[model samples]
Target: MVPVDTLHDITARTFASDNYAGVHPEVLAALAAANGGHQRAYGADVYTARLQEVLQGHFGPTAVGYPVFNGTGANVLALQTMLPRWGAVICADTAHINTDENAAPERVGGIKLLTVPTADGKLTPELIDRQAHGFGDQHRAQPGVVSITQSTEVGTLYTPAEIAAITAHAHGLGLRVHVDGSRLANAAAALDLPMRAFTTDVGVDVISLGGTKNGALFGEIVVVLDPGATPGIEFQRKVDMQLASKMRFVSAQLLALFEGDLWLRSAQHANAMAARLSTGVAAIPGVRITQPTQANGVFAALPLGVADRLREQAAFFYDWNRATGEVRWMCAFDTTEQDVDEFIAAVARAI
Candidate 1:
C-alpha cells in the first residue's frame, strides 16, 4: 500500500472514481476496534449476529446475510446458490458477472451467463426479454437467472418500479432474480426508498447487499431474501471460500455501519459529492458530461490535454471508454466538497 503521506503529497487533483478514495472513519474504527479480539472463528460470534440483524432490518425479519471478501465474491457465491447444475444466469452486457468475473460463474459454478444490452447501466424488461430469446429450445443456452447491478458501474440506478417490472418478467418466465447490490446502498439512498421497497417487495430472490463500496473496507453481505427459492445456499458459501472464518469482525463493521443507518449516510455523502463534481466539471470548457450523474460516479470526455494535466498530478481515474474517449469519475464516502472544488480548479487551469 502506498504511504498516506505519499498520497497526500500529490499535486492538486481529485480522482474521478469512488474506488480511488480511502475508507471512511467509522468503518476504519470498527476494524481497529476488532483488531485484538479473540472470539469465534467462521462467523459464530456476536458480531455476526449483530450484522445479521442489520441485514434483517434491511430486508425485514426474514432476511439473512453473510460476509465475503469483495463484490465479485459476494456476487458469484450468491448467484451460485440460486442455480442448478445446468441452469444459466442472465445479466446486462456490462454486468460485472458478464464482463468482469473472469468466468467464475461458468468455471467454478458450472453455470452459463447470458448477457443483454444495457441502457445507461440499467437493464429494462425489454432488454431482458430480448436476451431471453430461444430459451428451452435445446438449441440454445437456458435463461435461469437475472442479475443486475445497482448504481451500476456507469453510475446509474434502477428505480423500484423498473426493478419490479424486470423482476415480474423474470419470475413469470420461471427465472430467479438476483440483485448485485454491490452498490445497492448508493442506489437506495439516491432513490429515497426503503431498502425493502426494491428487495423483498420488488421480487428480488437474492441480493448481494453491498458494504464495501459505501463505507466498509472489505465486506459485502450476500442476503438470501427467498429461502425457499435458494436452498443449500449456506453450504455453497462455505464450499466456495466466502464464509469468513473470523466472521464476527467483518460483521461488526457492518453492524456499526448499517444498524444505525451509517450506510445510507455514507452513500448519501458520496452521491452528493459526485453531484458536486459533475456540476463543476460540466461548467469547465472542453469537458462534456457523458452520462447523467445519478449516483456517486461521473463520466466525462475531457480534452486530452486536460486529462494529461490531471494525471500528471497523480490523480487517480480510469479511461472507461477509451475507444470513444471518455473517463469515469467515481465518488466515495469520504470525498468532500473541497476535493471537488480542487479538482475543478485544476481543470480550469488545464483547460
Candidate 2:
C-alpha cells in the first residue's frame, strides 16, 4: 500500500473531517516559538500552568485541565478514571467512542459501552436509562458513566439545558458523566454559552476537550471537572502512555488557543464553513440534505453518480455509518469558502 502522504501532494482540497485540517496559524506560531524554550518536563511547565489558568476562566474554577496527545487518548484516560473494571459507558450508537476509536475503551480500558439508539447522534437521558437499568446487578455490566459527544458524530448538537438534564439524570443514578468533547468548542459557540455551563455547572465529571480538530496540530485536554468522582487520573494518564514527555509542546498549543479565545474563533470558522458547504451542496440537483449543519460537518444523501464524480474531482468526504446512503462532509478550522464552492461545483457537474 502506498503511504497516504507519499502519494498525496496538495493540489485541491475538500471536506472530509476536521482531523484532516492543518494547525491554525496561532497554534503553529506557538509551537514554533515554544521550540526554543526549555521548561519543566511531564506537564509541570509554565506553559501548561498558563493554559490551565485560562481554562479555569472558561470552564470556571470547577474544572481543571490535563493536556493529552489526542482525543482518543484523552477519552480513554478520562473514562478509565471514572469507570470501574466492571463498568459501562452510555453513549449514542454512532458516537466517536464507538465508531472511530476502534473500541479502545473496551480493549484498552476494560470497560463496555451501553449504546443507545440515536437518530441524530445525540444521546438522551431516556436512552441512557433504557440501557443503564437492566444491568444494575453484578451479573451484568454496571453503568458507571454516561457519555455524550458535543457537535455529535452526525453534525448535531444538544442545548446546554439538554446536557444539564442528561447529566443530572446520570448523576442521580450514581453514574458519573463524561463528554467526548472532540467538538466541544463548536458546540459551546453554537449554543452561545460559557464552557462551564455545560462542563461544570451542568454536572459533567470529565471532558475530552478537543484542540486538534479545531486548530492545534495535536492536543486535547481531559478536563477533570468533578474531581471527587474518580481518583488518580494524573497517574492513570502516565501509565496509559498518553502522557507526553516534553509536555510543554502540548500545553503551549492549548495556552495559545485558550488565551485569546482562539478556540472559539476556530470553532466558529469551522461551523460557518460547514453551514456554507451545506447550503451550496443542497443547491445542487440530486443532492439530498441528511442533517443540519450544526457544527463543522454536513451529511448529504447524494446520488451515487454525484458521490462518485465528486470523488473523481479531488473532492473528499466520508461515508457516514449513520447516513445509510449518504456522504458526510466535514469542515475544519482551515476550510475556506473557496473549498466549499469548489466542492459544490464538483457535485453539480457530477449529478
Query: Cα RMSDs of all predictions?
Result: 2.3, 2.4
Regions of candidate 1 where Cα sits further than 4 Å from its true position:
1-16, 35-37
lDDT scores for all predictions? 0.81, 0.84
Q: Model 1: per-residue lDDT, tens digit, 1-351?
A: 888879776533356555555667887888888777597888888888777877787798788887887778888888777877767787888888887789888888887888777668788878888767676677677788888888787888888889999999999998899998877888888999888998898889898887777777777878888877677877888888888888876787788788888888988998899899899989987889988899888999977656766766646677887766588878888777988788778777777
Per-prediction TM-score: 0.93, 0.95
For candidate 2, what is the TM-score? 0.95
Off by over 4 Å in 2: 1-11, 321-324
Model 2 steric clash pairs: none
- Per-residue lDDT tens digits for candidate 2, residues 48-85, read 88878887888778668889998999988888999878
Q: What's model 2's lDDT at 139?
A: 83
Clash list (residue pairs), candidate 1? 16-329, 16-330, 17-330, 18-330, 42-245
RMSD of 2: 2.4
